[model samples]
Target chain A: MKIKNILKGAVFGVFAVSGAAHAADVTLNALFMAQAAYSEDDIRNMTADFKAANPGVDVNVELVPYEALHDKIVLSQSANGYDVVLYDVIWPAEFAQYKLLDDVTDRIDDKTRKAVLSGAWTTVEYDGKYYGMPWIADTKFLFYNKDMLKKAGFDHPPATWEELETQAKAIKDKGIVDYPLVWSWSQSEAAICDYTTILSGMGGQFLDADGKPAFNTGGGLKALQYMVGTINDGVTNPNSREYAEEDVRRVFSSGQAAFALNWGYMYNLANDPAESQVAGNVGIVPAPGEAGVSKASAVNGSMGLGIPTKSTHKEEAWKYIQFLTSQKVQNKYAKLSLPVWEASYSNPDVIKGQEPFVNAAKTSFAVMAPRPTMASYQEASAVLQEALQNAMLGTATPTDALNNAAKTIADLQ
Target chain B: MISYRKTVTAWLLLTPMIVIILGVSGYPLIKTVYYSLTGAKLIAPDLTDAWIGFGNYIRALSSSNFREAIWHTTYFAVISVGVEMIIGVMVALLLNEVFVGRTLLRAMLILPLALPTVVNAMMWRLIYNPDFGALNALLVQLGMLDAYRSWLGDPATALDMVIVADVWKNFPLVALIALAALQTVPKDLYEAATLDGAGMWNRFWRITLPAILGPLSVALVLRTIEAFKVFDIIYVMTRGGPASSTKTVSFYVYQEAFAYMRVGSGASYALIVVLISACLIAGYMYLIRKHGEA
Candidate 1:
């Protein structure tokens, strides 16, 4: 039957080639940016499935380097060169601030709307208007090398920062590892995520309840100081200051670090025996708590899809967006990877029989903190990251750096 | 009459470049200037763009963040350019001498100038890494410090480290340019200066220096302009970080526009950067023209 289908496909191909001049083709220009998640096969399958779902819509999904996507999308949006593009959850405010995408609340049907993860709609919402639907839940979590911990007399991941420090120090001192813990300390989005972990676990707010840059308060200071203290105590690698997520991943994947505070997407990499030095020797858990509170790793990894306000094919684009974000398609994506839909989370296929993702899905949703919603969060985060980096390097004390960062962020407002 | 026609033809030949300039740069300049005047938030839903006349300028001027950014940026330019030029000139002069392996040395000196800026930034950022970096490892082994110190991670060392990286990366460009111009200077002039009781320093100051001054000044201006707009390395390595000790004007503009949704504010600050850059370029051009007249 497969051979017969292949022959039939070849005949169709020959017919299409012969009738190319007469038949009008529809091309849907699209963008896919998954820097930390999704292998090439994952992207190819996703693209293929998308094309299959809409047989007539010839989707041209070209992958771009994640770094260039934002600048390119924003710059192009001003002139209407790009029709539809993927966006990180953090970017909707900036995009909506520019009035780039059309409101999609009306376009999305009840079924599609309900299928998406709760609060997912609010993520892309700006000023009480819907813009994009979530693509995935790219949250952060704590990952530990179970084998390393077994070697060092521990059964499970650390429950508190204090426990983490003790185990990390024990491992480091005994020469179990050169550096026992690692995190994304690079001065980029990763820094923002790391800060989220520290701040949330310590019960700190990045900004006040009244929408102000409010990280210099008691809670905020304690959070910043705790993260800084981990390095001061010589637990994590100090070069974490310069580590991009990949650097931390490399260290963790090599089976060196006993504990890694990292993104949720690294589960596959940490457990693939062919790729990871310590495959199946890993245990993933929610990040450590502080102030008797569970750690809240910042929500990232998800891309939001929206129609451009000036799009010539607004109706068609909306239809595509609606269809793609439907429960059925969302379930299919979950089959491929964890789709950012409430229905997909409970889908039996997502785990492939893994307990960690199941635990993460349950725990992460309870404490998943999205990047701050304020329009100036990006700039504020950049300033704050620089300050944290400074403190980590001992160039300035955390108090001094946070004070300076606070002053700088307040100036922007 | 024929000369006039020929002039017209020459102008017609140059018209393509003018069209390109207007298309590529001129339009954005005009648009940016317009946006700078009116508060153009790139993503705001409100249709009524409040044309607060000079509001952006007032805000930018009063902005403490902008002030600190300008201060840090200028300091970087002054410090990095000074260091780079002096070192570059010295290197150029050393390479200018007829030494063993001159060909190989000249090629090797240009290697850093050849590497892409992003690669250079990544490589240097790695070397400057606090843990597992060669610098910290060497320092620890040598007992220079009790622990690893991240060079670009601390606010105090971040700026200086960036300056060092910038100088290390850029001094070679200046040197290569200076070297080319130095080689063009007749060697007999140096021999003449030497015969006239000019010692080593005297020969360099009286003869060699004068010959290369014109080209070197041009190189200095170019280097200064490039250094003034230091964005990528700072953006990549530290990201104006360690509490923004290295935030240059370009990075600030980028942050304001893209990071913050303050588009009008960003455009105005961009104009400020443009005005400063224009003045610097004009001064350099004036110096070059003056040297030509001299």
Candidate 2:
């Protein structure tokens, strides 16, 4: 009886050890945006690759629209939710202030920092702390239909905003399309991006030296005037007031508009014969500058992947984020969004099929402008969006609209 | 002894339901009330101790944005519910008739009601698409429109368009309820009305109207509440764009608490909305009681 008991105890010990090993498996829930930049399938596939390398870690991915991304991250803060989350460039200040994201400053080494583009670093930094890994280095580019330009007797895409307007006028006169330009000027963050691009191109400043509202004057006023002028002149699609990036893509892809201001993702999609009607006729350029202000314009529309502070599986989440943001993974999927790594810009594989995109990226990235980084950015951006819409809809003049926005934003501060 | 045991057993049976109600509804209501008076942030509710009495409520009331949102909500509720009531009764009256395809038509009415609101909103979004939307295409083809125009994009028509979508999805529910009520109305009343030399309109106003008023009022109250708290359809369709023309009180509250993380002000806003809803309910109940007595 004693011998049988010993053998049974030994078998139970083996079972206990195996159960402990099995319990080591970690399941992580990661959140990503469904629209623009990298596609949902690309995110899932990259995660799958990460899982293959790290056998013990399993990831569950959830994708929401860009408009919902900020709220989702903030709402899930206390729920112990989202081990890994994709965040926008404007969120780091707010997130860092709330301590919603883990400070991974030490995790990013000097060698890695040196290799990554310096501008991309700003996406994940706030108050000198790194909140995440910058994943998408994106900007809005000028997309034009080559056929329409040719039909309008223009040999080259416009090099400046004035030239672009002239070209648009030519296209409209030739009856190539009813509206020669379409923009994602909807009352969302998208409108802010386009405004920032134009504002920067016109040498406008978002704030004065003391961080006061300054956009209502100087180049800011010009940017709004320029946007309103396009609509008033019947060159810009009036429906653009209601359009987001996707709507702009649809209108441009369907050959309804000759020129569209959209993100980098539109390039490959607009050129794909399966997706766009005028695929081969697509032309890419950096958003045009003003004559004396800038050579090219772009918004620092990058995004990052971060580990939520509430995550219990922080180590595993960091591993997944690192794998996703690594140069190899980013370069492989550079068709939709360019890599943040400086060397990837010169990689033949990244540039082979999309030469114009690569060339435009080279110029645009250098001049990419940022929206104001503040904890109240969301509210301020809302005010700006409303102001932009009111001006565009002719409910208020640009001066009055921007003045109101400045006042509201000043009150928020 | 038997009576005492019965009382004890009943109390034991009711305890679980009481606990559940207190846990789900009571706890949250109390917490929301507590948070409304404090300057609490959404991220860390426990850390807040700044109790600024009624400050948030004052701010919310004085804000022009909040006032606009309230107006939008009221407009949406009144128009959508009013249209829904009219169309619902007409459809119910039509379906209640002894027609060959009555049963099939009744089943088909369930299709719109059965679809999820998000799916309905998405479908309507496509139908209203500026470039290739069916509505624009149809209107242009029929010569009702000179060109394709943005329906949801324009502030003048966006809310109305959303109301149209809401009405399409919800009128079937009212129709179903009204139809059920119509079945319970006796044939004798109508025959008596006819014998009394009543016209078609008179019979409808005197006999059918009174009989169905009770169920219709219930539908009215339910739909009014739903429409006043409208968020999902607007979120899916517009995200309250084109200059926030379609932004309702609930969407405003959502933006405050979740998007902006201002939990304190958000709670106050929510309570204000609740107060408005309560007043509406009370008004409805008073009217309903008067009708019942009459």
Candidate 3:
């Protein structure tokens, strides 16, 4: 009987060892990109700091290049199992189809919940369920050179579409500017973003709140027609044909265009007198309309961190998420002026901290609105971009272009 | 016993080569043919188990972009190959002369060939830059036009300029082949031509031309294949732009497969391109065989 008991104990010990093997410390593999936020060295140092703070937890972080990140993560994340990752907010629907992300609403605390600001946190919520933790927030606004506008007899930024067009015409007449408007009209993603803003602002929408086709209506056509007017009225350049995000920013910084519509990130360069030809006078203004009447500026670009549902290290991945979105870490990141983490903006140290960039978090984040959440947003954006491209090219009247896009979206639905 | 061992050693030496060719060349060729039939977007890194039939090919056939690309690619191949052959033969004759720097000059001539396609294209793009490029400055200095013109940006001039970049990049290969073929020609034939009171032109036409036909034919086939699949120059310079004016078939295939992620469609389109290329190669082979028989 004593021998048998000893044998049973040994068997129990073997089972215990196997279970402990499954209970080993989880090491979460994270993919992040640093260039947009800070220099690679700065991000690595920050990451090391985060690692030191959490001992015994191994965090494997991969720094993906900015241009290649969007396509790479989207494709790989679709292949079933992954631990945790950073992804563009535009891509959640595509990734969620694989059922690979955790719903972290329960795990989030008041500290984390309070850190995110109004309209920014909405990007992570799809179908009223949170699938990701917000990392960075970005949206579109107007970047006008204040001195140029001042010289053109405008004391303030354009108050409405009429004011902007009038100011551009004035700038053109004075022979001070080569082109009044310069922005992306290329066949890539920018074309979509620019078009959607114009369409939404004009009371045109890709889909109604009920998700029915809505772009082919009067409002959509008016939005498109206004762009055609800009192109034809010589406010926007014919060279806008060759324009892209880089080209627009380059030309705008060089003082070639009077008023430029660009994202909040333009603040970094526009404030730099060395990189910018029109630096000291650059001004940021919300694309103008009566308050609460303008199509709320659609959420432009934001990135989120989330753990895949099939990850080997769910608990550790959540901890890393906690670290990345924490006010402490976000405050450190805010030094780079990336517009990441709304909570960091309110932190006195983050606001007062001097980094290489001229800090503009307070101003840039002031009048921004979140992008609408819809499953079919990707398709909708494309339709709107096509309309804008057509309008800008003068191939179709704006009304015709918007109506056609709306009809197309309606057909798609 | 020694002869038997030598034969065994020769076969043994060739075994690794046989394995390599079968693995790298043969396997890929077979895989490509299979992939050509299936609608596969090689760019969509997000695929698990998705298969579509000749649907991609059907879509590619119906697509206007594919048709435009085929037309542009054909025009490019015919023009570039014909021009290269004429220029190559002339350069070969020039190099055959006993001149100072003849050896040195010939060595220098191969420099373009040595430079990578990507590097060569980058240099040319700068040369054509309208703002501060060397080409524009030279033209402006010479009073060729009233204002600085963007060579690659103007839709009218883009295709022609790209063809020029490609020809400049590739014509060296043709010249080297022609020169090598010229050396293999028996000196006695030239002597006979001279004895017959044939002038320089006649000697070049009758003896020199006939002697270099094999290598010239080979060069032509290779140039034609390269020109048909020309993607790099167009991609670097125009990106099928100033409108979709300079888009070649290969670039179109890349856009369809990679950019748009219409994988099955892209696959079929790519397969179609390969089939056309195969046909071209087969035709070249038939011509070479017929010429040899004659």
TM-score (0 to 1) for chain A, all models? 0.88, 0.95, 0.79
Residue A73 of model 1, lDDT score: 76
* lDDT comparison, 1 vs 2, better candidate: 2
Q: Rate the local accuracy (lDDT) of all candidates.
A: 0.75, 0.94, 0.69
What is the TM-score (0 to 1) of candidate 1? 0.83
Instruction: Return the TM-score for each candidate structure.
Output: 0.83, 0.96, 0.78
Q: What share of the true interface contacts does candidate 1 keep?
A: 0.62
Residues A174-231 of candidate 3: C-alpha lDDT, one tens digit per residue: 9878678876665445655566556556666556778776666755566556666787
- Against the native complex, each candidate's DockQ, computed on alpha carbons, is 0.36, 0.77, 0.10
How far off is each candidate at the interface, as Cα RMSD in Å? 2.8, 0.8, 4.8
Question: lDDT tens digits, residues A131-159, model 1?
Answer: 87765566677889887788788877787
User: lDDT of model 1 at residue A14?
Assistant: 92
Best by TM-score: 2
For all predictions, the C-alpha RMSD in Å is 7.2, 4.0, 8.0
Q: Which of the two candidates, 2 or 3, achieves a greater lDDT against the reference?
A: 2
| Regions of model 1 farther than 4 Å from truth | A1-23, A52-56, A62-69, A126-129, A173-175, A206-209, A212-215, A290-302, A313-337, A343-348, A390-413, B1-34, B43-49, B94-111, B126-149, B278-294
Q: What order do you get sorting by DockQ, best first?
A: 2, 1, 3
Tell me the docking grade of candidate 2. medium
Model 2 alpha-carbon miss at residue B10, Å: 3.3
